[model samples]
Target chain A: MRALTWQGVNELSVETVPDPTVQSPTDMLVRVVRTVSCGSDLHLLGGYIPFMRAGDVIGHEFVGEVVEVGADVRRHRVGDRVVMSSFIACGRCWYCRHEEFSLCDNTNTNPAITEALWGFSPGGCFGYSHAMGGNAGSHAEYVRVPMADHTAFTIPDAVSYERALFASDSVATAWTGVELGGVAPGDVVAIWGAGAVGQMAARVAQLVGAERVLVIDRVPERLEQVRRYVGAETIDYSTQHVGSELLEATGGRGPDVCIEAVGMEAHAPGPDFLYDQVKQQLRLQTDRPTALREAVYQCRKGGTVFVLGVFAGVVDKFPVGAMMNKGLTVRGAQMHGPRYIPRILERMERGEIVTEHLATHVMPLEEAPHGYELFKDKKDGCVRAVFTP
Target chain B: MDGSARWTAALVGALGIGGASVAATRAVQKARPRPRPDRWHAVTVDRAPADLQGVAAAPPEPLAALGDDLEIDLRPAPGDRGTELRARARRPGLLVDADVRDALRRSRSLLEVGEVVQPDEPGTTRRTVTSLPLELAIRHGREGGRL
Candidate 1:
């Protein structure tokens, strides 16, 4: 099977790799139909994560057809059109029982690495680095999905494959942010970054009844998308002061919830950005937390700040004093697909949430390396690059 | 070498290099784990302490996977966490920490979820020069975590 593989830092190639097979009773083989690039993929491509290996297939958000199943797979059969969650989880674990599927105890085959790094491993992620779980990603013709019954969902007839693909990760991740950030009816929400995840977070906040939302970004294309498609006000941080615009939007009380969707590889504004970049390059800090710091510092007193970004390790300047003085709540997590995916799919089927517009560039799997180039550079207004195998 | 042998050799080589880098660069979890003295491998399962001790009679695969010369004890965890299953080798040199930790983890998962979920085998990589360290950490990782 041909798959897009991570070759090295800032390197990718489409290579002929071994086809996957179902090895566990709860496992099923997914014939990849559409796999797309994500902002999180940039960390891997840039070698910020440090766990990636050459020849490891690289893709996660996808919609596919079930081509095979193991004996204990009771929920799905071959030929079923499905969307797979990026996170692999066993439905029977204590975390899964509590709807925190990302924290499942049994899924990450390589637990010690993360347990040693972050004190405990979360769960296995497809094509994510080995630190999460060294599962093969979906950037191939076929992918073996573990715990298929819990991780893969059947797409509704009303939902197109393109629309359902986002539900596998982005929309679910966005929903995790807004829902866990505790967005309430009529509350004001401010989101950092206007990428696909940020736009989806704005949409989820609106769906959950946040009356006013503001999306901040420097990219003119993304901010335009936020205003037009996401129906949120935009702040081009490159042009206007983000703090001033946020204050004006919320009428002085500040946003009730501030969500940071930009991860470690954030582009900072000026000299301070270089400070973080240098520290990160020097291995002093594994992440650049410029957006995260802004989210924490600018959030309203007693408000909630939710992190929806992919951060690897320590950062230089996090605003702990501001958080402590302001009495704010801070939280973050990987998406719990089963907890939010069904409703997201239902919304997609009903045309309540539309994501086809996010696929700015669509091409064959062979063009994945170029696609990554376009996405990593944020060129050609490429919100996301969708691939067909 | 045939394909399988080449792949295995490459993976082992990567693990070797990665193991050394993991110790040097990461600055924690010595690439080589020294078994702690008088330390017991323990897991807190959602099941009751009594149920875990009783399961040893008709041992599950997780417990059975460990040899017969193991001494096991179960007690309620503090703060209502769950039952704590503690075990150690009956003899001085029977099992290493990794073996005991791995067995305890499997036993807890088997009792709690009925089966230990795993990643796909024959996986997706051929193990590259750069992929070695993370690969090695993962290879030795099944023994729970630093905790």
Candidate 2:
């Protein structure tokens, strides 16, 4: 099988790897039809995440067809077109019972333990790294999926793989963020990071009946895309203060709900000396506190703040006092991709959510590294990239 | 002897009865459990991947003793062995020896590391001792007994 592997920082290559096969009773071997590079893939290439080794498959979020299934995989069978969740879950744990698949008790993709299990990890992304369950990614000709019945959802024929791909992660993550933010009908919502996830969050917010949606980002093209496709009011953080813009957009009351989709590598200008210190710290306090802190401070009293970004290590200096003083409710989670995949697929079938617009580029699997670079650099209006295997 | 002696004996008997009654009341009072004080401290730590650049370190002072009643500790990785903190209070008639442990078994941050500490043993003095991964232990110490 051919797949894209991370060689090192800023290094990637298309290499031939062994074909994937069933490894567990709950496993399924999917013949990948389409997969895409996520914004998070940039972290692996930039060496932001440790233990990502040479030749580690790097991609997550895809739609494919099950060519084989293990005996215990009763939910799906051969020839069933499906979209996979980014995280592999057991689906029967206490957390899964509550639809918190990301916190499954039996799963190995957890951030803390993944490094020991695999060379690298990314919250259990497909085709990303070994640390993320090391299950071959969907970027290859064939990929093995563990806990198949729990992680893979059948995609209806009415939905195209291109449209269903985002359901695997970006759309699901955005929906998770919006849901966590407690977005209600007629509520004013603000989203930080107008990337694929942010855009999808805006779209989902509208679907869930948000009265108004505002998106913030520095990329002019992405901001424009949000305005044109998502119908969201946009603020270029590069040119203006996001908090002030959100406040103005919400008539000075601030948004009732705010979502941070940028994750750990969120860009903020500061002294170069602070960069290393900031990168090593991963708590909610110091990791990209600007947008999140602004969200906390600017949220309407008694509103909710949802953080969907991936922060590593410890965080410092969170605005805890303000969160308490304003009576703001803050909640966060890695997307329970398995739980949301089915729902997002149904919405896609109804044409309620248009994911195709989010895919700005598509290429063969061999060019996967280039796709990562383009998406990372935000070049050529690269909001999302799809890889056809 | 005389009528006066007889009267003194009778009064002494009555005083003995009163003393017995007081002693029984004190014993019952001592047997009852003491009410626990309302004291809490909020603690939070990052549970993200370790390799990512800019991953924040645990607080310089992770442990804190708040208001002389509550203590908190935060760490980087709560670890496989799990971690715990002990909290205690003093009250009359309480066993004061019973240990009280509140196991934070279902924390998202704790992951597989179960039981922040075994649930507090009852009847002990009010003192909270938290045991977590080394990073959090140090962090708690640096926080000066505040969350």
Candidate 3:
């Protein structure tokens, strides 16, 4: 099996690895048809995330055909077209029952010890770092999916794999942010960082009937794309102040909801400051204070702020006072792809939300490293880069 | 001096007692206050520093600085002024002006304590400083600044 592995910082290699097989009664083997690079994957490439070792398969968002199923896998059968969730969760766990699949008791990626009989220390992830349950990822010809009944959703015949591919992570992540932000009819929503997640979030906001959706990003082309396809108002943070623009657009009231989509490797405005200095000196490659600070400063009072972006480590100088004084509601979690995939697929099938626009480029799996580079550089209008296995 | 006089007197007394009881009940109800939709109201404060300061006191001068074309008006309360802000901008409307107010307010706070400032806006950006014994809020006109 050919898979893209993380060799080191700024190093990704596509090599022939052993094919995956069903290891547990709950496991299933998927022959991947399509996979997309996640914005979070940039953390691995930049070495921002911890414990990402060499030869670790590096992908989490993909659609595949189930080639084999385990004894306990009842919901899906062989040859079923399915989109696998990024996280592997036992549907029977307390957390899974609550739809908090990221925190599922029996499903961490870290190796389990006797003391932790059921749950692994690292949360289960497809191709994320070892810190996230170091299970085999989907960026290969074949990958094993644990908790197969809970994690993989069979796509309807009408829905194309190209559209359903994002259902696993990018679209689901945006849906998570939208749900957390509590978008409603006639509400004004602002999303920071017009990456794939941000674009999808803007679309979701529209689908939920947000009266006005404002997407902020420094990239002009991406903003234009969002405006055209997602029907969202774009704000070039490079030219305008995001916080002020949001207030202006919302009539001196900041957005009723704000979503921070630019996670850990978010670019800082201007040169390195004290916080940047500390991070640089500490050899930390991740942390973006500007975006989070702006989100806090720009969110409306009594409104919800959802953090969907991945943050690698500690963040300093967070504005806890503003959050407290304004009576704002802040919530964040990893996207429960298993929970959202079905809803996103339904929306996609209805043509209410288009995931196809998000795919800027598609290439063979052999060009996986190049795809990673393009996405990391954010060049060539790389909103999303898909690799076909 | 007979049965008719006694009946009238009893009826008058009964009416007086019933009226007094009704008045007492009304007073109690007024004192306790029942939940009503009209009574339930919420005031949202925008996280922008300028708006926060404006609601705390008077509107800032930067807001007032917006020009007349912007149609900047200040309403006391419970008016649809906020709605007007959204309707005004079609193609890059009042968004720039609002941003300027936020920038001015941010810059003012940075200047108040005599801190060396790196201007958010490039070149020699100008600001009119007014010092009061305490903080005096001033409102800006729409389309007022060089934004």
List model 1 lDDT by residue over B23-142, tens digit each: 665564455576565667787787666666676566566666776867777778886567787888887678777888888888877888677767666665675654645665677878
lDDT per residue as tens, model 3, A109-136 = 2322211222223246877754565566
The complex in candidate 3 yields a DockQ of 0.01
Better of 1 and 3 by lDDT: 1
Full ranking by DockQ: 1, 2, 3
Ranked by DockQ, the better of candidates 2 and 3 is 2
Two-chain DockQ for each candidate model: 0.56, 0.01, 0.01
The predicted structure with the larger DockQ, 1 or 3, is 1
* Candidate 1: residue A371 lDDT (0-100): 91
Over the stretch B6-109, how does candidate 2's per-residue lDDT look in tens digits? 65765675466456646865786579863335332222222333321221222121121112332334334355212232233333223121222211212322
Over A322-383, each residue of candidate 1 has an lDDT whose tens digit, in order, gives 99999999999999988999999999988889999999999999999999889988899988
Query: Which residue runs of candidate 2 sit more than 4 Å off their true CA positions?
Result: A109-124, A128-131, A269-287, B1-147
Worst 10 residues of 1 chain A by lDDT: A88-97
